[model samples]
Target chain A: MALRNASLSVNKGEILAIIGPSGAGKTTLLRLVNLLIQPTSGLILFNDVNTSGDDKHQRSLRRQMSLVLQYPALFDTTVFNNVALGLKIRGCPETVIKEKVDNMLAVVGLSGFEKRMVKTLSGGEAQRIALARALVTEPKLLLLDEPTSNLDPKNVSIIEDIVRAANTKSQVTVVLATHNLNQAKRLAQRVAFILDGEIVEEGASKEIFEQPKDERTATYVDGRMIY
Target chain B: MIYLGGWEEIGFGLFRALQLIFSGDPEVLRITLISLRVSGTATLLGAAIGIPVGASIALRRFPARTLLISVINTLMGLPPVVVGLFLYLMLSNFGPMGFLRLLYTPEAMVLAQLVLVAPITAGVTLSAVSNVDARLKEMAVSLGADPLQEVRIILREARLGLLTAVIVGFGSAISEVGAIMMVGGNLLGYTRALTTAIVLLTNQGAFTEAIALGIILLGLAFAINILLTYLQLRTKAGLFAAETERHHPVT
Candidate 1:
């Protein structure tokens, strides 16, 4: 499939979910958005500014968006330090850093885990800390790569709630990639069904879940196990 | 030419050797001290140049990296005799560096060891830096750390391996003889070290004294190895504990 021909826009404060089988390029799409891997050919506009020329410009654009990997890539450091890292990079003042980290951690329901080591955290707890790490940067957009995959059902619900709340409270655009249809319906306003490196269908989450456009989307939403 | 084969004779010879060492025989004492000093200097100088060079290579991409690494690997295996002869030629009166008059001096011995050890140090340090977790670099860059900041992080994570590199370099320098003997002239009470002295005593039929010096050199090498092993183990344990204590299950 043509990699860069696909186009999808995430509006400010809108939660867009992309659901697909494994090897459908869902993670590749997120990686493209994160600029970790550039598309062979495509237009990626952040704030209507094309960031394809200089790597520095692309990095600057990246600062405006945070991508949370499926496995929370926390540092081998304390939770507080991990959450404070982005601010530290931006050279934020000490007092401001402390305040923002505390607020962010609290929002992610990890208020007292500041000094805790990353290795001791459970999968869900680590994911929450990862969320706080991303949110502390105050990015305009947050892209998640199956953030709830390793989480328990309870943690999954909590993560869904937190994503919804983040979109509402902070007006941050949320783009979640998952294979779980129920989560797509619960947390996303719009859903895009991808298959074989192509977006098969794109529409409102409710309509897409109830009335999938393509056979692949229908099979995927119907839980026929496309993967 | 001579035959004095007896247990009593052997005992007497060993006793005389010990007496020579303890009574502060200037020649023996001077050689031991010079060896240590030269080896120490070379190791330190090697570290000063090697670690940073290795770190830079590991962190950045440049043309000729493969060629550079191949050259370093080849240098790591360089023959001490060849190095000694090459330096001897370069520092002779007819050569450009002859005005410095460095040959047959402790400094010359040190310079030779530096050449021999620098490549080993750099190669080991490069491996250390390369083995550092890539996730750490990605994490640092993702946080907008500049190249310097990223390298600092790499160095911090690679401290133990760098220390090992220094220890190994020192071990290699201390045991080398050809370079020291050639450049140091193995001069009496001057630039002689354990290896050169052992060679000198053997050449002069001082078998008992040479054996004694050989024993001491072996002891020194063993001690250095033990100390370095302890240091390596301690650093690894410390890292393990630190990682566990601050363990973020992420990348």
Candidate 2:
């Protein structure tokens, strides 16, 4: 499908990897799913519900889903507070909020970092915190935009582990956009290879990696510059 | 004799002014208190109205926003005398609001100052609110914050600049003589302030007292400037400290 016509369904507990070169409309697709930008003309259905002008519906859809931007922008607050922000917005009770925030931090491998400020965290730590912030609300759909592109190798692995663990423990449906092929193969169960805003290949990650139906997909997977 | 007075005369005037302040002369103290009252009330009233209006304009998109901003900018430079005359007419016997019978009263002076300072307060505050990081606004909305929460976040982030707006309104109100003189009737003991008193003394050819009042006015303005500067520095430091804590988490 073209950018205007493409549609993908993400099942619960599934990690859908959207792999593409630069300017393949991957980020734009994520933004459209997150309601960051409205498509020129298309329908965005969340949980089988059409989200258009109804602010309440849109918010409800977004409340159950969240997008972690490529650049993790932490609020100007301590890490504990940042992680607790989603609960705060939902008006969660103090006792429950405290317990849940503590658990989420521990889940993200940041058990003792509740009091730490977000600014001082390393790249890996910050991404984990960002993930924690998104997961604290327990979103059903988690959209990640190049979440590990900026990290070093060690940090990339750390982020991958965190992402994989989040899916396993929470069963949070995740859709990750990435340019790194290895990452997609390692973490994603299903992969969609896109070029120039069109999906060229889609199937189980291993299937797509083993047998490509399209030459463009083969070349892209083979690391020849196809753009 | 009129022309021969030099440094000695000016020095004597300054001495007498200091003596009057230290002695707490009833008229001088009373006028100072009234000036403070008028300026302080105006500043508060202006801020109360201006902050919300500015914030609304900054946050929401509506038709003719450009025209509204243009009008506010133009009003910021409105002459004091014009405001005075407008208020005078409005509060006069034949004007629409004349039933209040507020002309020449301290309240009238306050009204004039409010009108004069509101634009300054709004304009400054508008610029401050508009300068807040757009990402912050977007993030707040994405997090399900209501409109009021959005405003609170914006105001909290831009508190320093908002304070500057209040200080600017106060400075302008306290130093203006034309509007107060017109609406206040410039009475010797009833509505006189440092600015009106200086004007009255100058008109009466009491050059010594006028010069003395001028020195006091300068000192007051200087003190206000220093206080505002100190507050600005403190606020900036606080914002930076907050930002650092947010960006750089502690071990």
Candidate 3:
């Protein structure tokens, strides 16, 4: 019962934020979208194609998207290898991988840190590397689960700016799940408020946060407990 | 009936064994080298088969998986003598594999040890791969890793554990005497390994040679443990340093 009866649509190149309290199924929703976990029931269509099928099709669809987990699970390797993994999996040439990895690291403010071990990085640095790794492939869609959670203000700002740049410059569709209402307000073009495994309300970001149609959504956005 | 001379004989035997060790006695060295060769071959063969089977069992889900894992775990404790008996029957002249004429040879001993070692290797590898962070697989999938790449990534993360499996497998193979004794027949200058030689020398009342072989066996085990332990410690230290850096940022 992690997620149920939750229906929503995300336009291409749009930034959609899923904001809710803990255990509200925001992460579950993002996982569903990423096809990392399949819905027990319901159809998930990607570009008019159903994604729930054999592994080959799923893999093909997944290559066009990237999901960054909250904890940023980096491989036990160097930053360069971690960032280059997606491109490598796609069979990108060594020269192209090197160039793209370098560019991504630079964009994430980790220009000279390619050779450094991922385990040696601080939390902020590791999170940035995770973002760089996710964005390196220039995915058509980016799914972020609490990307800035537990980071200091500086790291949060850096991550938000990176997400913004990726969306605006690359036109990558983004579906970000976070508990921080303020972050939802700042970043998302549209917002969905989920509670108890269901989307309680959905609309434009400004209307959902400032003029929430549902009482539960209003309570959540107003900083009041709504369990 | 107190056998007061036994203590003096034991002391002298120890002295002679040390002398043989230091003097590079060819006979003693040959026995030690044969022991390593037989056991090393078994271990390599075991790992080559065991690791992939173990990792696959850990990563996949199907009916009877629990039963298979239980069978593997139980086999890890398989008695060496039982393996020896089973192989003895299989490789004997009247048996199905009799045409190969492998019985009473080093090859027969290796086959017996492989039976004893493969399960241990696979069992340890199963535990190691299972202990890897589950989120790592999910992350790999989200990052677009295909099935093969996902396995490669998981195996890389679980390298230390896999090495531990090899060490355990090798240790079991090298230290086992019961199986090899039954199959090898301990032919001198040919099939005789350190453990079998020790047994033969003791039975023939050549206490000095037995003691020498025992000491060399102990030394071999000690050397291997020391090297593998060093590697394990170095890996642990690197991981610890990385963890420390992750938790404490230089701001």
Off by over 4 Å in 3: B1-18, B225-251
lDDT of 1 by residue, A1-227 (tens): 33544688878889999998877888888877777777787788777888686666766777778878788887666788788877766667778888999999888889999878888999999999888888889889899989999899998988888888889988999999998778888889999988888888899998898887787788888988645
Best by TM-score: 3
Measured against the true chain A, the candidates' chain A TM-scores are 0.96, 0.94, 0.98
Q: How many backbone clashes does candidate 3 have?
A: 0
Write one digit per residue (lDDT tens) for candidate 2, span A1-227: 23844667777799999998989989888878877667788788887778686665666676777678777766655687777766666667677778998998887788999767677888788888888888888888889989989889988887788789889988988999999999999999999987888777788998778898888888888888657
Predicted complex 3: CAPRI docking category: acceptable
Pairs of residues clashing in candidate 1: A73-B251, A118-B247, A118-B248, A119-B247, A119-B248
Where is model 3 chain B poorest over a 10-residue stretch in terms of lDDT?
B242-251
**What is the TM-score ranking, best to worst?**
3, 2, 1
- lDDT (10s digit) by residue, model 3, range B32-125: 8889999999999999988998999999999999999999999999999999988888889997888899999989989999999999999999
TM-score of model 1 vs. true structure: 0.80
Ranking of all predicted structures according to lDDT, beginning with the best and ending with the worst: 3, 1, 2
lDDT of 3 by residue, A1-227 (tens): 48887999999999999988889998889888899888998999888789988888888888889988899888877888888877777777778888999999999999999878888999999999999999999999999999999799999999999999999999999999999888888899999999999999999999998898999899988888646
Best by lDDT: 3
lDDT, candidates in the order shown: 0.82, 0.81, 0.87
In terms of lDDT, model 3 sits at 0.87
Clashing pairs in 2: A117-B249, A119-B247, A119-B248, A120-B248, A120-B249
Interface RMSD of each: 9.8, 10.5, 13.1
